[model samples]
Target: MNDALEIDDLTLWLGMLEKVVDGSTNMVVVTDRERRIKWVNATYSRVTGWSLPECIGKRPRELLHGPQTSAEELSRLASLIRQGQSVSNFELVNHKKSGEPYHVALNIEPIRDAHGEVCAYLSIQSDITERRQQERHTVELKQRLEVAQRLARLGRIDTEVETGRPRWSSEVFRILGMVPDEAPREFEGLLAFTVPEDVSDLRRSLADGVEAGEELDVEFRVIGRHGQQRWVRCRGVPACEDGRYTLPRSWSVQDITFYKMRLEEKRQRNEELNQLVLARTRKLEESNRALEEFSCALSHDLRSPLRHVAGFAHLIKENLAKGSVDDCLGFCDRIVQAAGRMQNLIEGLLSFSRMGREGLNVERVDLDAMLREVVVGLHDDAGLRNIQWRIAPDLPAIQGDAVLLREVWINLLDNALKYTGHRDISEVEIGWHPHPDGPVFFVRDNGIGFDPEHAQKLFGMFQRLHSEPQFKGDGIGLALVRRIVESHGGRIWATSKLNQGATFYFLLPNIADSAMPSDWGAVESVHAIGCRCGDSQAVEPGLQS
Candidate 1:
């Protein structure tokens, strides 16, 4: 029974020893006193591509050492082994059976006999090729990041809140114009470099961010250690663990002086442009006012002389009709016609000039009612030409100056009647329709229409489409219509086909309100006084007496 128990214990001890050697991931080799390989574990054979049978009779130098192995490391390892001591943590290059070089971390220990003499050596090795390559890659990445941060003028900072301590990267020190050794170690020390006016605000913002467990973003000015001032934008976020903020906050700061300078330049340029526009607008308004006054005075003064010439010529014709004076009568007739044509031209010019200068009193006016009144007045006039007129039903009301809009309708209808002269059953149509944005009023006529190519010129002062003999006109009617419509924030245009017909369209805004009454009575009184002198056949009685 005692023998069996001893055998069982021995088996267990052997199994544990086997496991200790075989289970190790590191390559292991055992050698005798002459440095001849005695045993090699599985890992050693796997790593070096040499079986135990191939390596058992060879020395350690023969199995692993080559020209690549450093002579200094070998000498140090030999010295330690000779003194019956163990050597550890030595790095060296070794060769495989395939002639490939490999780096390893080697630990060799000398085995001692009972007499205190070294009898064998045990070696443990770990392949470090991949680990060394990873280290190189990490170094390269750090170098690239540093270069990028320098070009971007950016800096990084890390601060521990519990200790109020701070650490800056190399770029941060460079940005602050301080050496790494000279950098501030405490938060207060870093805050001292900030501009006096911005320091308190930055502190408040940082405190709020930390309290709320939020990210921080702020812009402030700082004075570098060299006394140089710069604008910087800072952004940072906290890292937390286990419901408490454990990691120091990390932040990036960037210089923004160039961007701020560009914004200021743009603002200055805009201010200059606005000033130039204001000056030009003022000058243009002054010139327009002066031109309006000159046109009014010219029209007012020319009326008196024109009336005198027409009256005197008529008297001469009446007196000469009693005698055989054919030549004198013909001369008087030419004089009367020329004076009448000049007076018409002057009136047309005055109306065109006054259209743009007049103030607008905009209100809702029923276009249907206004057109009805205009058509009735035209039909009642003496010596009116025969024409067919049609007005559409349910014309919508528009907001506009009533007096100015009335003139627009009158001028359009009169032109239609005059241009269709002597035609059998001359037709005129006045109507309104709903447009996309507002109401459009139109006057259509079956007249001697002009070409569409010349439509743009139709609304110019004195822009007669036909000769004086073909169609007599001062050519100011459409021009006055265009000005009046535009002054009420509207638009005017015309469409026509030669010899077929012409249609004039104008748009006005629709508003729901009552029409504002104008001082039409005063205007009529003024017109009556002017017309009385215009129709008189004799000179003023006071001048004659």
Candidate 2:
């Protein structure tokens, strides 16, 4: 009878609380210290499809959360309530009794007893399923807009109508040759980069557009980063408040440099075709001058090697006449070495001639394994044993001739080793620099480097920066490297400080030989290596047969 009376009293109190919580939209829950649900507002039954008696003894998570609910948020909620504190704006994913997922923001507080001890926890849950979905949709649209602008080669800028101070998109900054997120400077400061002839007209058009609330469009030239000339087109559309108070005007800028360049090239080509007959005489004269330079360089370089063979041959004859067998053998060795030097030079010349006349035998080349083989061959040399070698992994594969590309690595690595022979602990690194143009391969070595002033001469035939005895070469190796790289539509250069390390860089397109360099198949290619006649030099010491 007493249990029956207690049940009657509890039912009466629940009815009163339901009337108090009438029209409240939040799903309110009350759980004891053991997390058994003691009471739930009518909103919880309406939202979850569970009646008061059905959820009277269940934990909230078991009824409303599943695999997708955030474990972190649940842990945080438990910690806050156990510490007799309140947690607001905590987000969690929950499910209805139908197993449909929804998002909720929880505001929870711990209910205290008379002695300040925790008794039950009260949680107010606000459903935010639609709001979270809207936020995700907004992000997706923003991303699509950015991609579209980039693909159109267009960028936007907004400028205050009176001051002309600008706010730019990332692409706008790129179009203007400024770094993204860079600090802003005065708008007039940019005029210094604009071509003087076009600046006044461009400014006048923009100012006129702002004053009259008219559309503006113009094209102008400006000096870009690194002093490169670029042409850009700007179109402006203005916005106003109350049809009179002008605000920031939106400007669309496009990089039209390539289009202008194409027009100029088409015109020049037309003129070239019409004047072919007149250009022939000038071409022949230029050809004649180039041939003389090539002949001079070959004659000068060959003379020294040939003279060594002749002079040593005569010395051998003298030693025989004196009946000195030991001296004669030594002179014979020197004669053979000089002959071998001459043979290598002739071979290089023949190879270059063939490279010019023949089309590339292009094929896929696996660079990483091939370089491993190249490094192994270099390690076979006793002189390079003490050097530290670093080869970057996962070098990209390129399509080119196996023979020519192999030669590229051989010449570069050989030069690195030769130049670094002086250091007690030599170091050489082979890596690549990737950019929008293509991959740039570099061979860096800690060596006795050359003076920067003579860098331009390093790739010329028989050009030696050091003395004859200090470093030995006909100076043909790097010239050979330059020849092969240019043939593959690539460029080669070097940088160094004296006595410090040097890095030699060569950039090759992804598919080499796809677009050959100018004068690619020229018959008289020897002129590419022609330079002032200098003393005859041999290959690196110990390179003789």
- RMSD in angstroms between candidate 1 and the native structure over all alpha carbons: 22.6
lDDT of 2 at 314: 87
Q: RMSD in angstroms, all models? A: 22.6, 26.0
Query: TM-score of each candidate?
Result: 0.46, 0.44
Stretches of candidate 2 off by over 4 Å are 1-15, 158-166, 177-179, 182-197, 222-229, 241-248, 266-545
Pairs that collide, model 1 = none
Per-model C-alpha lDDT, please? 0.72, 0.72
Q: What digit string (tens of lDDT, one per residue) describes model 1 on residues 216-334?
A: 77888879988988777778775677776522367787777677778889999989989988977875785475476456446643565476677767667676777757666666776
- In candidate 2, where is summed lDDT lowest over 10 consecutive residues? 531-540
